[model samples]
Target: MKMKKKSATLLTTGMALTLALAGCGNGSNNNNAASSAPASGSASAPASSQAASTGNGGSAVEITFWNMFGGGEGDFVDQIIKGFNDSQKEVVVKQLRLESNEYYAKLGTALSSGKGPDVAVAHVDRISPFVKAKQIVPVDDLASKVGLDLSQITASNLQSVTYDGKPYAVPLDTHFHMFYYNKDLLKKADLLNEDGTPKLGEMTPEGFEKTLAQIQSKVPDIQALAVNTPYFQEPFLNLYYEAGGDILNADMTKAAINNDKALSVLKFYMDVYKNKYADLNDKNPWDSFSNGKAAFWFGGVWEAGVLLGDASKNIGAMPLPPIFGSQTHWASSHLLVVPSYVSAEKQEASAKFMKYFSEVGGSTWGKAGHVPANANVTASDEYKSLPYRDQFIEAQKTVKFAPQTDKYTTIVTTIAESLQNIIFGSESPEDGLKDMEKQINEVLDN
Candidate 1:
């Protein structure tokens, strides 16, 4: 669960929205690192033996890296930095870990001022405006300079960061939702399969509800499904995407969320809340699921450490069922990018660091619960050894990334707020959908 604090006022376009989106950190900082660490003695060798020495008497090139990773993710990043620093001693990488809430604002200001980190982490969805504003530079040539083969990356992951036929960033991983179920609770409800999986019957909204109703009837005290009402956008996007809904039309010129597919998904969730299939008021729904008070959860791959770590928890994970039609679901990627303001030498150094992060550090990163974007890493036996990685990979295959629009941050924030109002009864679903469409159009027009 990537916890983002939305602003009260929407940032419509230009540099403001881009900066806000850039700072938006993905995933929760509450995850425990202990559960996500790689097995002992499994670290791979250095990604490159080539030196990143400055022309000045073989001095190491020093570069600053910026990111919003915290808790377990932050720990993994720290390890990667150490590994890169120790690998060849040609480049020294220093990191500045910022609080996610304030990250984009500062990054925006720094980029505008041409004085910030040489290397930084940006979400794929958030970099469009930066590209427009020329705050970040393309990485294809730089990657080649450092012997980093961009072709080794997953094609979709590579494509997400490409604009105008040039790659801007090195994608780290694809993060998305997984259906997690409590085996004990499912067994009590007679919904557990003989294979230790949930016997999810009939993959329709109504059929899924029937399964929930059974759990409610048999195991009366627990929440049958733990809906993420707090971060409602995630669960909303997951199912809406499955239903073949798009946030914008093909041209990316207008709002496209006010259709039957969107409405159906909204109503389905409303019904879930109304029927007590899930507790709408459970403020800490993630905690509820982790504490065994909920039978099912549409949790993130980033949660693998917490949800799948304990053998006693009896948790099982799989790709989200294709209830609405297809397995397509919402996903985002973490990308390593170089600011346009960075020197050519630093950009090359950044490229080296990015290559190592993708090639050598990828396995360690996968332990932090994201599906590594490196094709080689995913094919490696080490990545396959992780729990539920195959499911993560499968889910990653059909993910629908955010539309390539500069106004996406504003549009999505509006959707999040509007969906909340609709679900909480302040506005009817029909009215809310109309208002949301109008609001998005206004932003797009601006």
Candidate 2:
């Protein structure tokens, strides 16, 4: 029953967010490396010939890595792995690119069967169940041996991966929700300040509404906000957090979402779609923003690399505005963990790879638009100078992660459906909130 619960919760998040990308490196075979299954020896490693000739006189320990990263993020992971492979002679990390939905379930199953990858990627919030299931091993000793600087990592990020005072995973990056604006569109709408930043008069609900209205009135052809279905639930949650709402009560015994603040936030979200400031049915909201048809986009810092790399676009980024008198932001972190079933040698090798990618290769990952969990890296001149990163770096302080519970995926899934229903006009915010509260409470009670 516990395993079943783990599989259900983990798989839901994996599948919903997995991305596949082109231009992956590190000798990863495009044909064999991509799989929706867990990384067993027979399933997701490279052939012997793919080993790094430069590493350990061609006798490197090749370890399997299972992760859900694709597109630009995928490319960055592959590059980091390739760099580690090239720089070392002791470890050759072979990556298995798994689709998100298939990843967690397969990983849980394989770990139970003692056939999981040597190293795996787990989101900070999602790591708890794996820890409880005893499927992932703590990396403290291995991390120490590899000279991992835990002290240099951000306090909140380090805390996220720590379970029972033991470090179960190495945090790679902090991906938080932030605001992305089209420079030209905001300027045309007269929403720009003297410094060229969006001059949304205040952070109040009315202020935000007026700003959206101004942009919509001036642009006419573009959306004031660009967002897809998968991302629709975030702003609601962020606003709820800003309004001083908590997902769970003090004891984590039940859902605490059916409140006035939540209702107010939900109503505001629905109005965005109703007023035509955004399209509820828009298939590719990022496309609208990317093509200069949207003035404001609320998305992860991961969008930084793509927008900055595009020479045709002028993008400005900022933390999500304080719409409810607080600047709370939604956030999550990518953590590198070692599965418990691996041998000591493999564990050490995996730890070395994790350290390299997260510490030595931290700068490169930062360039991809995520805030590195490594505090020293973030403070470095290189990271500080990256395209719009400095503008939103301050948001790390107020970033609010989802509640840490085994039922997180279930709760998030419930809220997402309810949000979509409200946006689609199939359910009213009041009804949606009631349903969300009931469903979430049921999950918690179970």
Candidate 3:
């Protein structure tokens, strides 16, 4: 039910891997305006008021922002909301920190009560449910107002937030996957070229196996791979894609667990983590990698964000090694939104503040280890020049996203569990998946 970081150094080091930031804008709170329309029917529409002002007959537009981020990510968010507060503020964004587990339950309760954050941070995966519930507004209005083109965001990442033909939320950034191998070990094992990085293009699942075999033969105590949850399961989809298995038919109503391609992926994992081709019995694979034991791992740009602390002195990165014909990174993004409950006055003020957040705050977020979707901000001299951006951007070009469906929570929860069984020896890959198909398809049937 919970995802855990690996136990080894490379894995444990990833314990800090998070995709959050201090947030958007100048992070300053100043001028306050009255609500766009008073809810009580007698409030005046001041030229300058709080960003929370809404035109509910002149009531303050109070929006609660529910988020799973609470790191430098929180600080980043604070800055942006503060700016919205400072701008000719009619809309007020009040942010509430929710543990990853508590986020949805709280959101559900709020929505049912008509008291939810006007603009809560909803994931692409969570979009369908909110759409079905009518809790959020289609962002097209705001995007048009600001001259922001949704096409500017990565299509794959954007796909997640789109529902029933309309885009519900804004695309944030690609928190995509990567495969990190120990440069030092690969070199010692003669797996690297003269440049010290492995010949990644040639790093197939078979090749990945051979390289790990080499490491295992030479270093008996060290595991050659790590199987961090959720992240560990991510590669399977790409591998399945490579193996030629379509997760669902166009209808999104059926499971293709029976596909031979997906099965091969499971078998591959069995060899690496369960069948014993390499030693992978660790609590955290990334830790094994960072500690210099595990040779290859599947992680993401967000994973590297955690390493932002002592990056220069600590580690290295690479695109995910080839398991399929071409490289496909797994990723996600974050966005800033204006909810429908806010009045037109607050919407205008919130939009202005959001613009500032998108501009200045975007780059600040990049500093906290996230790639910003704000083009002007992301392309600035500082962002493009940062060492982290230079290395991580390579993966953004080919990243793929998990299908964002209202049922994603149920889907991921079941799949992650079944995948654990396949990797940890509780069941055979094929056997586990056949059973998994039944369970997943049931959700779709509902």
Candidate 4:
């Protein structure tokens, strides 16, 4: 269940090209990026005209789909595609599985050039630029045409894709970090409760640290907590969001991360490292937790398949504690979008695929460890039966999605790079905050 790492180089050069070409206007085919091969089991037939119909023995409308899913998630997608194809004859969805690191760049190029997959996957945070550039079409009318009930989608997930009072995409799943504890290690440290949950002293940050200290005292050999230092942004955002911090000002006109809340969160991580509560140098912290070398971890819900499915691991997951203030934490979603350049018929077909993905395929997607955006799927008895799904649902309720600014990609990347320097002592927290604020404000201004 390894997800692809975000490539900074691709994001910078690729998205820059996307925005530049978008500024030149749509329906251009000047870019020459190579197209990827279709996934196994997808149709290879040429796309049908907009007037084509699937009724009365008409040709099935062929539409190209693009996504970055791999490993276990990829398997689930393959199953979903097969189910959709077998269950009907109205539409045929051909898929192109792109390398995640290069996905956005290639997608940007495709959209700008008016050539590529008719439908594609976009992160909630990454779509702001696309929507602003009009590279993707609004899906509300298309969903309605396909008999997809938009009201059945999770409210928060739906809200995330809405721009200018219109839904630009159909959200598929909300993915975020959850609190995972090694039950066997907790039991050995006398921190496991009677019902197999961790027993904490209090809900405050200090109280949480004291618990970590106690774990160190009882089981000094293992890391009390495994902080994700490689992708430091997730852990940092989880706590900063809990502290009610914002990345931008009210109108999104400037930076807003230099306040006390952020400083306190950064200091908290510094203390965790200083006290040896977590190893600052554990590069593969997720593996450390998975291999039973860490007592606790803040891991993504997507990892549930490997961590929770195996009873031998003795893992128990719960919503992150309200240590800073509230349950709010960082979250992002995978959404289905139709490029604005797609034909109306293909847009309708894409909506049907989205409906199936949200309705019928959601349970299978849930098995891949994401909280399905379709409320009906989450409410199903089958979905409720999965391990720790209740906790996953609860955690999603308070998720703080990235701000809806076109500058988000640049801003977040800046934050990630600066935070790493701060955590590694390359700069003091105070100086780092000042520098990060300046950097973000510059991005916003541009």
**Worst-scoring 10-residue span by lDDT in model 4:** 32-41
lDDT of each: 0.87, 0.82, 0.62, 0.90
lDDT of 1 by residue, 1-446 (tens): 12322332343344676766565532222221221111110111012112334333467777778899999999999999999888976688867777787777667777777776788998989999999898999988998899999999999999898899999899999999999999999999999989998998999999999999999999999999999999999999999999999999899988999999999999999999999989999999999999999999999999999999888998999999988989999999999989998888888888999999999999999999999999999999999998888888888899888998889999999999999999999999999999999999999999
lDDT of 1 at 213: 95
Q: What TM-score, computed on C-alpha atoms, does each candidate reach?
A: 0.87, 0.87, 0.78, 0.89
Model 1, stretches more than 4 Å misplaced? 1-58
Flag clash pairs in model 2. Answer: 14-100, 14-101, 15-100, 15-101, 21-71, 56-89
Better of 1 and 3 by TM-score: 1
Q: Which candidate number maximizes TM-score?
A: 4
**lDDT for each residue of candidate 4 in 163-221, tens digit (9 for 90 to 100):** 98999999999999999999999998999999999998898889999999999999999
**How many residue pairs in model 1 have overlapping backbones?**
2
Model 2 lDDT per residue over 1-446, tens place? 99999999999866654533223432355433453355345453545425453435766888988898988888988889899988977788878778887777777776788876889888887877888899888888898998987888898888877778988889998998778889899989998888868888878888888899999999899999886655677877878888989888877788898889998887787778889898877888888888898998887788877776675798788888888888876799989989888889889999899889877789999988889999888988989888777775798888877777878888888888888887787887888888889999889888
96: Cα error in model 1, Å: 0.2
Which is the leading candidate under lDDT?
4
Residue 435 shift from truth in candidate 2, angstroms: 1.1
Residue 180 lDDT (model 4) = 98
